[model samples]
Structures are given as C-alpha cells and as structure tokens.
Target: MPLPRLARGASGRPAAAPRVRLPREIKVLLAAAFVIALGYGLVAPVLPQFAASFDVGVAAASVIVSVFAFTRLIFAPTSGSLTARLGERKVYVSGVLIVALSTGACAFAQNYWQLLLYRGLGGIGSTMFTVSAMALLVRLAPPDGRGRVSSAYAGTFLMGGILGPVAGGLLAGWGLRVPFLVYAAALVVAAAVVAVMLREPRNAAGGDGTAASPPMTVREALADGTYRASLVSAFANGWATFGVRMSLIPLFAGAVLLAGPSTAGLALAVFAVGNAAALTFSGRLADTLGRKPMVITGLVVTGLALGAVGFTDNVPLFVVLSVVAGFGSGLLNPSQQAAVADVVGNERNGGKVLATFQMATDAGAILGPVLAGALADRLSYGWAFAATGAILLVSALVWLAFGRETLIREPQLQQRPDGTA
Candidate 1:
C-alpha cells in the first residue's frame, strides 16, 4: 500500500495525522524475516548439544557459537559493499541460499571442525542478508511509517523466536541433526519467497533505470551527531539486551536468586511478553511523539528497571524487573532504528552505514558478556547488573544531551511528482 497523503487545512498545513500503512515490499520482507528468525531459533537451542556430540569439550562447543558472531563482525563490511554493488534483492536472495547451504551441511558434519567451518560460513551469509534487508527497508519503507514498519518487522522475528524452539524441541525428539535440516529447509523457503516477491524501489535506480545510486559511506554517516548517538545506544543495547540478558540472566537466576531452570525460563518469557506489549504501540508513539523522546524514555526505564534486578533477592521482583526492562527495550528499538533510517534517508543505499551500526551492536554482544562475566566472577551479580545498568544510563544521558529527533512529520514529508509520499 502507498502511504496516505496528508490532508491540508484551510491554512494549507496538514490538518491531521494520516493513518500509517505499510507498502507491499515491506510486508514481503517481514514474512522473510519471520522465516529466517524461526529457522535460527530452531538451531539455537540444539547447537551446543550438537557440537558436544562430536566429542568436543564444553568450552570448545561454546566456541561453535562464538565463531558465528565473530565471522559476522568481520564480514559485515564486505556484506555492505556487496549489497551496494549487487543490489539488495540479489544480495538478499544469495545470502539466504548461502545460509541454507551451510546449515544443511551442518546436519551432515562428520566432526566438530567441519560443523564449526560450516557454521562460520553461515555467519558470512547471515551478514549479507542482514545488511541487505536493512538497506531494503531504508529504501522501501515510507518516511511517515518507518517506525511502524520497523515494529511490525521486529514483531515477526519475536513471534518466530517464540515458536521455533517449541517446534525444534519436538523435532529434537527425532534426532539432534533433524533441527538443523529443518532449519535449512526453512531458509530455502524464505529465500524463495523473497526472490519471488521482493522488488527494488524505482528511486533506487538511476534515470536510465540500469543502476542504483551510490551507497552512503560510513564516513558520511559518522558526521551526523544522531548517527553517532545511535552507535552508542546500539552498543549499549547489545551489551544489555543480547549479551547480558542471554548469558548472565540465566546464570543469575540460577545462582543468585536460587531459582530453578523453570523460573529462569519464565523470566525470559515474561520479558518477551512485556516487549510484545510495548511493540504494539511504541512505534506509533515514536512516529508521533518523536524518536528522541521514546529513545530517552526507553533508556531510563530500562536502565532503572534492569539495574534494580540484581539488588533484589525476591524472584518475583526479579521477574517484574525483567518485564519492565523488556518493555523498555521494545520502546527503544523502533525509535532507534527509525532515527538511523532518517539519517540514511531513502535517496541512496545505506549499506556501509547500516553495516557499521550493526557491527557496533555485534561488538557489544560479543564483549559485554566477557567483561560482565568477569565482574560477576570477581565482584558479584549485583555489581555486574549495576554496571550494565550504568552503561545504559550513560547512553541515555548522551541522548538527552546531544541526540536530535529524527521523525519527519506529515507536514514535513516531501511529495514526489508521482503522487507518492
């Protein structure tokens, strides 16, 4: 669907806000994202166990997980350059197929090293599709509806993350390798869907319609204060959300709270519940109230709630804090993404810019657990959580002090000659 045009008032200003409608391309991308995330979740729970089955020790098995991320970090820039040269549609399809091949290979691996190599190869493909997808969104998403589009996209991934594990666990009853094959099959379907359905934006092409505009460089993006703030926030988000949440939360629940595995699972689920609830409306708020406010609010709420998680001994309080922190995360993500989209705009490819932004987050996810784990070991869980919260709070302060709002209001949207906004 095309975005609704702003109706004018007697004074020639936009009379009221138009309803947000997503375009067909974004919908297709969302479907693809769901399939990709679900396939990923299918493997996540079983990967370590699968690695251990090859006679590797615990740390070695764990390395299987880390290698994927490490490769993604290193390969991101190459992915960005590929997207710029090949176009998002081509790169996206190829990336999905690469992952499919690697994942399928994982199912037949004869030893730990083979599995490691295949999994590491998947990371290269992972960044290829990831960078391309973000670029496509920047090109295709309507200016007025970027936040809502981002929210919907994120929601699909969350839903898939929730459902994939249950299905994978059931499939695991067949064999550890079954899930890998299933995931590979799912990726193939996703790739087919995108290759068949998604199309590049007309504006992305030159006057001859033979080529795309030059990609926005990392140097250009870095010149913007908002983009810089985005990197900082992205890092903090990775540190707290991806790194600490996955690694430390489970450990803390088990060791510090004296909670069972079930409780830790419940805490994670509650966080998802809270995140889903916020996603329902946060996008619209970001569009209307502005991205900067939502980001700052999310940071404060997440920082305070997540920071408090370690200080409390009560499991109930811990669960409550977890939910609150998730809500804050939901609030922050769409706005942060929309702000970055604003910086990139829709005029040119943001491949390198988006890749750099992704790298910061990936770096945080990689480093946060290591450093935070040390604090947890030498100090205490309280100190670790406190430090995590402090990081978020510090980012919030940065935004409050220097970040600019990136939402383009209805009145501000420029109309093209073709009548599209």
Candidate 2:
C-alpha cells in the first residue's frame, strides 16, 4: 500500500502532524514480525530443555542459546553491508529463507552438537533479517512518526510472543522437536508473505528517497550522546528481556515456583500481554513527549520489577512481576529505537547504524545467558536476576548522566547568561 505524501509548509518543511494510520509496507512488515516471533516463542520454552535432552549440563545447554546470538553478533556487520547493497526487501526475504531451512534442519538433529550448529547457522539469517527490517522501517518513517512506527513493530512481535508460548507448551507435549518443525513452517510462511507483500512504501523504484546523503559511519553515530545512550539501553534491554527472560525464567519457574512447562509458558505469555498493552500507547506518547524521560522511567521500572521477580516464589506474583517488567520493556524499546532514528535522520543510510545498534543488544544477549547460567549454577537464580537488574540500573545512570534528547526540534539550545552558549 502506498503512503500519502506529507504536505509541505511555505518554508518547504513537512507541515502535517504524524498520522496514526500506518502505511501498508509497515503493516505487512509487522505481520511478518508477528509470525516469525510466534514461531520463535513456540520454540523458546523448549529449546534449552531440548538441548539438554542430550545429557548436557545447564551451562552447555546455554551454549546452544548463546551460539545463536554469537553468530548474529559476528555476522551483523556483514549483514548490514548486504542490506545496504541489495536493498532491504531482497536481503530480508533471503534471510528468512535461510532461517527457515536452518530451523527445519534443527528439528532432526540427533545430538547436542548438531543442534548447536543448526541454531548457530540460523543466527546469521536472523541478523540479516533483523538489520534489514530495522533499516527499512527507519528509512520509511517520517521524523515525527518514528516512535509510533517502532511501537507498532514491537507490539506485533509482543502479540506473537504472547500467543506462541501457550500453543508451544501444548505442542511440547507431543515432542521436544515438534515446536522446531512448527517454527520452521511458520518462518517459511512469513518469508512468502514478505516476498509477496513487502514493497517500499514511498517509491516504486525501491528507495525511500530520504537516504540520499552519504551513510553515517559507526564511529560518527557513537560520538552522538543520544546514540551512545541508546546503545547502553539496548544492551540492558537485551540482557534482561531477550537473554535472561527466555533462558532463566523457565528454569526459575521449575526450581523455585514448582511450575511445569505449561506454567512457564503462561508466564512468558503474560509478560508479552503486558508488553503489548503498553506498546500501543507508549509509541504515540514518545512521539509527543521527549525520548529521555520515557526511557529513564522505563529503565527504573524494569530494574525494580526484575529485581522483585527474583524474590517471588508465588506463581501469580511471578506472572504479575513479569508483566510489569514487560510493560517497562515496551516503554523503553520504542523510544530507544526512535532516538537512533532521530540521530541517523532520513538523509543517511541506516544499515551500518542499525547494525551497530543491533550488535549492542546482541552483545548483551550473547553474554547474558552464559554468565547468568554460570551464576545460577554457582550461587542462585536470585543473584542472577539481581545482576541483570543491576545492569539496567547502571544503564539508567548512564542515560541520566550522558544522554541527550534526540527528538527533532526547531529551536537551538538556549544560551545561559553565565558563560555557556
């Protein structure tokens, strides 16, 4: 679907306010995200346990999780280059296809090593899709519209995350490998949808028309205070939400809460519900409200909620805390993404910037599981959660000290009477 053109003012700037109606390209992308996340969520509850079916310890099982992120972290730079050269649509579809094949292969793996290899290979594809998708979205959205766009994307994934786990828990009863097959099928379908439905919303020729400027270099982006702060925020978000939430929460459920697989899935689903609920509103608010305050508030909330989760033994309390943490995550993520978009602007290629941003998150994800798993093994789950919470607190402190607002404004910084200009 084509997006309506933005009206221009007498001064030749966009005069229209951001609209709530999303463009077709973004809508289709959100659908694809939902399906992909749905499939992954199905597998999330079972992946570690399935790996441990080979008689490995907790740390080794975590290797299966970390290996996927390790590959994504290493390959993200290359994937960004590919997205830049080939355009996002082609790279995005190809990436999904690779992951589909890899996930299908994973279903039949007879040993831990085989599972590790297949999962790790899938990570390369994951990076390709992720970087491309983010680049595409950032490119297409108007400056004022980025927050809502980011939220819509994240919201769709959260919706899938909510539904996939319950279904996965039910399917897990059939076999540990069943969810992998299902996930592979889902990815294939998502790939087909992307291939058929995805188009550059603005230009038929495939450019968004805004990326005409020379692409920003990674070093340049890092120099910006806002982008630097976003990296820290992304790292903490990944460490807690992507890494430990998926890997350790289930283990904690079993060991502490005395819940079974179904309950663990329920906890994950509840968390997604909380995230989804907040995301719909958070994006629009971020667009109007400034990025820094929302992000700072979210970090504090997530940190406190995550820390609380470690101490709760009641299943209801755990689920409630997870939901609260997810809400905080939903609040933080869209704003962080919008801040990056704000810095990169519409004139520069976002591939490298998006890739670097992704790598920061992947760095935390790659390390979190291994470290948390070791910590859990040596000390306790509470300590592991505490460590993850501490990371968020530190991230908040970093933002408070060094972060600058990235939302585009018409006025320059006000000069003070003392000496500052």
Candidate 3:
C-alpha cells in the first residue's frame, strides 16, 4: 500500500484541500498592506515640508516628525491589549480607519500644533495596525513557512515604499495637500478590502480540532533569551535602516560626498532595489538553513558595509555600499521576524509580545536620528556612520552570545514516542 499524504498545521491535522499557493487570508493581508503602504508612500515626501508651511522654524517643524514616534511608543501597550481583546481583524481595520481619518485631517490643519496633533494621532493608529497585523500573520502561518510568509509581508511594504515617494512627488505638483486626501482615500479602500476578504484562520479562531497552548505573557516572553536577542536586533534594525538612513544619508551624500540631490535619490533607490532583491531569497534561506545564521551574517555584513561607507568620499562607491548594506538588512529582517514567531509559537495573546518587539524598533528609530545627527554636527559624518555601525555590531554580538536557533521542524516532534504531540 502507498503511504498517505499529509497536510501541515499546528495540530498536524490533514488539510481538507491542497494548498498549492499561499493562504487566502495571507494574500488578503498583503493586499491591504500594499494599498495602505501605497498611500503612506504618497505622503512621505511632502509631510515635513507641509509642516514647515505653517511658518514654523525647522526645529518646531521637526517636532511634527518626532511626535508620531512618541505617540506610537506610548500607545503600544494599549494597542496590544486591544488586539488581544478585540482580535486582529477588528483591531486592524479600526486602526486603519483611524489612521485614514487622522491623515486626512492633517491636510486641513492651519497651524503647526494642529499638524502635530493629527500626525500624533496617526501614530497611535499606525501602532495599532502594525502590532495587530504582525499578531495575525504569526498566528495564521504554519511554523515551517514563517520565514517565507514574513518575507512576503515585508515585500508588500517594500513595494509601497518604492512606489509611494514617486507618486507623492507627482501629487505634490498638484498641491502639497492633495496627497494627504488621496492617501486617506487609499487607506479607506484598503480597510474595506481587508474587511471583505479576511476571515480569521480556523486555528486562530478556536476551531473544532485543536485547542491552542495558553498565550505567552509579556513577562514570560521577556525572560526568554531568544526574545531578548530579537529586541536587540530589532533596535539595531530600526536604528540603521529607518533612523540613520533617512536622517543622515542625504546629508552624507550632499555634504561629504559632494553629491547632488539626484545622487542622493539614486543612492536610496539602489538600496531599496538591493533590499527588494534579497527579500526574495533570504526568507527561503532562513527557512532552510536557520534563522540565527542568516541574522548574524546580515548583521556582520551590514555593519562592515556601513563602516566602509563612512570612510569613503566617493559618491559612486557610497551608493554601492548603501546597496550592500540594504541587502544585508533584507537578509536580517525576515529571519528576525521568523524567530519571534517561533517564540510566539501558536500563542493567542501574542499582541503584547509583538508590541514589545515593535516598541524596541520604534524606540531605536526615535532616538537614533537625534543622537546620530548631533554626532555628525559635533564630529563628522564619518564618525556618525561609524558609530551607527558600531551599534549594529554590538547588537549582533548580543545575538551571538544569547540567541538560539528557533525554527521548529515538525518531523522532529513526530519522531518522539506515542505520536502524542
């Protein structure tokens, strides 16, 4: 007799249907993200300049930027709690709606403080959606495919990131405020699609066959060494990728490399291209080899690349190095996300844990720019870039010392006695 075919799932239940493609819910989530991201991208190029339109000084205008992170930091715990109570679907949709409203309101703000308030409100919504989306993705995906699934999710954001600024620039030609209204509309459309298309997975919705393990607590998750390493890595990822890249790279291109705006733009585009390309393969590598090795390799490569970018004055070389650094980041991200999902491990109430992980990144993004910019002003661009590299290196060291491989292969558990797992 021939052996029976089996399906993969949390309870090892045989699938009723063959899953030749990614799950429908996952596709829906990615679609929603792409649309939302597109709108977000549309607004990114104009936000800072819009804030300055109120006749505020540069420092005051910058407050508009910082307040978003500050609000996200403060609301993270609450966002997690809501996710646990309301479930990811409700929370995700509601959060998107809130963000849409707030972002639209920003277009009408007549003064600097008004813009700041609206932007801050949007931050809270942003956190709500971000944490809930992560919680949903982790819960829905099978353990074996976590890395690839995360890469897909990340890819949607990259698509949005790539297209948004370009679209935003074109919309700016119409009016500075036009993009905000369009972004708000795009967000609404995204929320509606998610509402229509997304149904919670059977496992996550407490279906008939399997009872889930008790959800892990924030305190418990924090005590785990792997989780701690994730936090460290998350912090560094945010610092280097989000914080330093945006705030300092342009200045380095302009002042240090003696490059023009076009060169700076090209450098950013190159980095994004590298990042997108790596996302395609890195996730599969993480699934096959393991999360720890990929993450460590990415960190080391990124650190060395950043350090090298600092010492060189050649613009072309700088662009090349930035692309290399971005590729390293691409390798690191999916693995890091997969590792956290491993620790989360079928828990229902992972919102708080995910929130905490996200908070670490937000905190790094919030702090990195101010500190790095101060260093660049006082010392030099080279020193600032080098210091950022050092932080990433330290984060990698932390992971090396404390992190462990987290991919849980199902076959290993099946090999144990009684088939009772």
Clashing pairs in 2: none
Considering TM-score, which of the candidate structures 2 and 3 is the better prediction for this target?
3
Error of 2 at 159 (Å): 1.5
Q: Which consecutive 10 residues in model 2 have the weakest lDDT in total?
A: 1-10
Please write out the lDDT profile of model 1 over residues 1-421, one tens digit for every residue. 2223444556685454468677888889999999988988899989999999988899999999999999999999999998887788999999999999999999999999999999999999999999999989988988878888888888899999999888888889999999999999989998888888887654546767576567789999988888999999999999999889888899999998888999889989999999999999888777777788899999888888888888989898999999999999999999999999989999898888999999999999999999999999999999988999999999999988777777656554567899898
What are the runs in model 2 whose C-alpha is more than 4 Å off?
1-18, 45-62, 108-112, 169-182, 200-211, 251-266, 312-317, 372-383, 409-421
Q: Which candidate ranks first by lDDT, i.e. highest?
A: 1
> Which lDDT values do the candidates have, in the order given?
0.89, 0.85, 0.86
Clashes of 3: 0
Candidate 2 per-residue lDDT over residues 1-421, each given as its tens digit: 1222334556665443457566788888998999998998899879999999999999899789778888999999999898777778998999999999999999999999999999999999999999999988887777778888999888888778777888999999999999999999989999898899887433333255553455668889888887899899899988999888988999899999999988887887777787888898888777766678789988988998887888897999999999999899889999889888888776556788899899999888867877988999999899999999999999999998888777653433346799597
Q: Please report, as a residue range, the 10-residue window in candidate 1 with the lowest summed lDDT.
A: 1-10
- RMSD in Å for model 2: 7.7
lDDT for 349 (candidate 3)? 64
Q: Clashing residue pairs, candidate 3?
A: none
lDDT score, candidate 1, position 71? 94
Task: Order the candidate numbers by lDDT, best to worst.
Answer: 1, 3, 2
TM-score of 2: 0.82
